[model samples]
Target: MGARCSKFSLCWWPSHIRSNRHDSSDVDEKDSLPGFIEYSLDQLRAATSGFSPDSIVSEHGEKAPNVVYRGKLEDDRWVAVKRFNKLAWPDSRQFLEEAQAVGQLRHMRLANLIGCCCQGEERLLVAEFMPNETLSKHLFHWENQPMKWAMRLRVALYLAQALEYCSSKGRVLYHDLNAYRILFDQDANPRLSCFGLMKNSRDGKSYSTNLAFTPPEYLRTGRVTAESVVYSFGTLLLDLLSGKHIPPSHALDLIKSKNFLMLMDSCLEGHFSNDDGTDLVRLASRCLQYEPRERPNAKSLVTALAPLQKETGAPSYVLMSIPQVSSSSKQTVPLTPLGEASYRRDLTAIHEILEKVGYKDDEGVANELSFQMWTNQLQETLNSKKQGDAAFRAKDLSTAIDCYTQFIDGGTMISPTVYARRCLCYLMNEMPQEALGDAMQAQSVSPDWPTAFYLQAAALFSLGMDDDARESLTDGASMEAKKHRN
Candidate 1:
């Protein structure tokens, strides 16, 4: 993951901001990150509806360095797919090298990479979907209630930690650490985008769009170092404090004259303590220092913010009194542990009911009876699962589905993830009824699995059961929230 942090983050910022700047876009891809998958272009196209316009997720729309699209895999898992412009990487190997490097990073405060696709002219990077949207939306474009002081402090701390983690891993050049690069997870925690690290392009251009957002040194030297990242971080601090894009120079002027009240966001009135605000102001001032060496390192920034971290049991959404997740399907529901044994019992009950009233296919032996031969059956099932996974990665839906069915038909093991994957494939094939059945089977296997409910919701929606789909979506969302809360 650290390798990914160094690669993708470097590619992220300058790529987005480049206009007349010196291009510096070469990526060193010697490092290997664990658990990163190589996705086929067809799979990405299927996931993102052929890179349709409706899937655009970037703030600047299609005109940016890379376009982002929201997508869902065959497993009902949501992801954000970033596709670089055609000219960004003329060499396919260069693009893959950059992507492979970025795909290695994984951190709680950073969006984790799911996979990458490098086919012909296409260079795509897939990462975990953040449902709560970007920090810019919640701050500047705030529609709901204003963000609370505690939540802001939390966001600051989380961003600092993310930067600290990246810097510690030798990924110190975060090209643009702005509000747009900060996203909120399902739990409403702030996640620093790995996309801020912009790699030097082949054309020698270093930066792009919105020159006002660029650090002074970047404009002068056309290069970024560790200290340059601190400058961007300082600019971000200003954004958080003012709830607007105040120039760093202007912000420094305000800070010098003890005119913090004027610099602070009016919407945050009465929420923060005077001392805390002053402390943050001071820190931001230090970060905005003209001389690169005068700026505090990410580690030092984290240390300074340590005392300001408020200890409260309240989640971010609650503290701000504003919904974090954008989904209308969100629900408030408490959760508790349902042991594995209980889940197995549920699966047995469901199987009995399904056999009695639900659809049934001829398979000679009972699933329950099949489990007695666990030793050989489990191994065979695992092998079939591997084949299914490989087929799924290759975008061979029919073959993948067949493989999964073979695994499930064995019935020696209960894997909700497998059921969910097959369920999604069924949905993709326009077999909503089968998808719904698999979703139910998944729930029976692992009743606490949030994704099973979501798959049920998707299947229901396809079948025109709008109200039921809404209910299922709500249940899934609630379960997801519960998982995060725990």
Candidate 2:
């Protein structure tokens, strides 16, 4: 007879079997590459406040055709928006295909692509924002102490891993893999920019920097390949070794003359041993080999540098001396009932408050509809609100959302309370972006309503936006106190 199955037996399965299942699921998810989104142009515009000048984060000025802006999504998540010029990608389909391909890549070593936008005569790509800035600023023009030797080694290894992962996924061509393309995340870990994965333009020049830094093969063929990327990586290796950007040709000459000390950065003295220096220099020489086929692959580079890693147990933030707050440092603040629910992100308590308040706050708000239009649609709009209120009280979120959307689209009347109720419904359904939009709409309809700010705070907190949520909560508290005084 077959073995009998029981709950106890299910829980007592072999550890290796469970481990293998988990690993297989991870590989499947990575290969499938799900979760990439296509954002609307209006959404992107609102995120950047109509692409304001102050939001510009790209090193290139705003006049540059391809400019990157830092923006906050409706969900309160910060993102980097790269807007390409109109003529940059005239073929919208091709631009979208390339972005989709890059968006499929998800890795911790990369500033992974989040989404893209392709509207009429407009093309944009959205990526996870890196707040700390680029490798160029920190390495060459550091305001604080120079990047330590361990951090430099970590950057090299992390970059190699990024390239190796990309190559494994059949994305080997990286245009202009330089210090500027490398960025530091909030934790100060190095990440390769996904923007470099896509070509700038169909007929545009491949290399943006000086021709002296270009690979010999690229110069001859007028095209970049996997080997060309390896060549650029070698130049970056040289940059990390030296405090400044030295021409690759001159650096190779120094390497050939056995002047290892000359190639080393003065700031890195007393940090790395002679053996480590010699090993890195030899690796850089192999990467910069004249023959394209003779260069070591990314996997080999990882192997060569694995044993050279320093401070293996130390966190990147600590090694880089970047300030980070610990959980223990956070203090709890006393809050009113509504404030307490928002602070704790209690969706049910918020729903209860919405039901209790009802449309009492919306009283005396004027409607600008003409008599004829009001007579035509007033009953229909009122019916939609009545149904939405019933669904909201019944805790039927989907029905409530549908009814509220109907009432909103009717255009005969405006109700901030209805928007707030729909905002809570969206939150309970795990749609924070839509919830945030509704909350903002509520504030626009009734700017002084403290409940609008409270709902906004709840939605922001749900999106992991602690700082913005706290500010919104404070605003709500102040408004409530002011109303009481009146």
Candidate 3:
């Protein structure tokens, strides 16, 4: 969660607004938040042509997708579709969870939540669709370029105002305020969306919840404080100002450079206003302070950007440098106590989550079983790479074999999980042939792992291929030695 502040008290948000004419049931009791519309699952399915893959609007690829379905309401108004991945999906309980937590805002800078659908096993949410996608798509790319200086502030002000409104009027925290989530309407107004990552202090834990947007204190303590949000907002401001992803891991090193120009989106083509951008740079720097106390509150952040709102016009986004992630650099955190799942870089864990959701509507029983098995295989692949002691690591091989056999039955698209664990388990069982076969498979999946090499060597040794075993053993030993050094 981006929001985390227990010491700083947030004031009434809608500091500059009037109430919506929509129904009151949707508003928060404390602040009378904005109203929302609702839609049924049947209506959404029809609009999306039965929720086909072609209807997908924005995808984070393979995993978290923002599938868009074009549908008309009973009254004939067109609505945009949002088919969320299962983790971010709202069941009946989560529907109100988001609305109550952060969906009550009525601002030009924020998107309106229309309604949602939660059929027996399917889940989807709906919001007023902004024709233009996220500012991120343009601002963070090189070939696409950056927005004009004046335009950057315009977007920044609108977002600051929205953030201010959330803090003051709604009394909620938008724990995830990344550049990728803000949407631009037809008229170029930024409508904030996706409160699926929000947390409510009124719920009483007093700590923020979203991790990518949170600081260490919030992570160390299970408190959802308002200050945490201030920190997150600061990070957002920094991203808007600098035009780069402020990874908490590299935040310190980047800050040490004090190179605001390096941080600013280079795509702006040198169009930013001199004084205004400087001020924004300073404010953004303050918001991302390592010390929570050093960060400004929501009111201060809004006040800092107030002057820049005066120099606005057609919207343009800043072009910041995009961070490059190695193909295999993705992390794998255990989704939950076997109840939930999240995205991973490799093909692993994709099926476990599908099984958890368990589609029952139209698919055949055998297909369902095969799907479940494939998902199980993905989970096994994930578990194989997790951090554990050598003793505990031994069990991962056997577990992976079970998972691989299930998917290798030729019922799924994902690759088999058999090869990676073959050597380890074969070594355990003294079966060189099975070990060699699996070692080859493991190399095909991820050649970066030294385990596959070591296992192949061990298999060769058992097969009496002394020269091959010696060379492989040396390579494997070197890799293991490097691993130990790290």
TM-score of every model? Answer: 0.60, 0.62, 0.51
Query: Global lDDT for candidate 2?
Result: 0.79
Q: All candidates: CA RMSD in angstroms?
A: 17.6, 17.4, 19.8
Worst 10 residues of 1 by lDDT: 1-10
The predicted structure with the larger TM-score, 2 or 3, is 2
Residue range 1-486, candidate 2, lDDT tens digits: 111111111111112211111011113234423367899999999988799886788845334467888877765566889988777788989989999999888877788888999999888999987766789987998754899998888888888888888888889999878999999875667889999999755434677648889999988888899999999999999999997899989999999899999999998889999999999988999989999999999888777877788886676766775422111211111134677578668788888877887789998788888888778988999999999989999989999999999999998898999989999999999999889888888888887787887888788889987667766766675566446435
Clashes of 2: 0
Residues 1-486, candidate 1, lDDT per residue (tens digit)?
A: 011100111110111211211111122222422377889999889988888886777734344567788876766567789887766668777766766665666666677666888788777788877766688888887654667777777788778777787776667776556788899765667787766653643422444466776767778888887887787778787888888889877788778788999889899888788898999999988887778889888888778876786644566645653222223332222211111111112223322332242222122223453444775577888799889877765557799899988987876755666776677677767798888888787776566666666567667767877556545655665566556435
The runs of at least 3 residues in candidate 3 whose Cα sits more than 4 Å from the true structure, single-residue gaps closed, are: 1-35, 60-70, 74-76, 84-91, 100-103, 142-144, 197-214, 222-224, 248-258, 313-486
Give the alpha carbon lDDT tens digit for every residue of 263-336 in model 3. 66666645766666667767766776767788787667667776666433222311121111111211111112
Model 1 residue runs over 4 Å out of place are 1-34, 59-65, 201-208, 320-486
What are the Cα lDDT values of the candidates?
0.66, 0.79, 0.50
Most accurate candidate by lDDT: 2
Give per-residue lDDT, candidate 3, residue 396. 58
Candidate number with the higher lDDT (1 or 2): 2
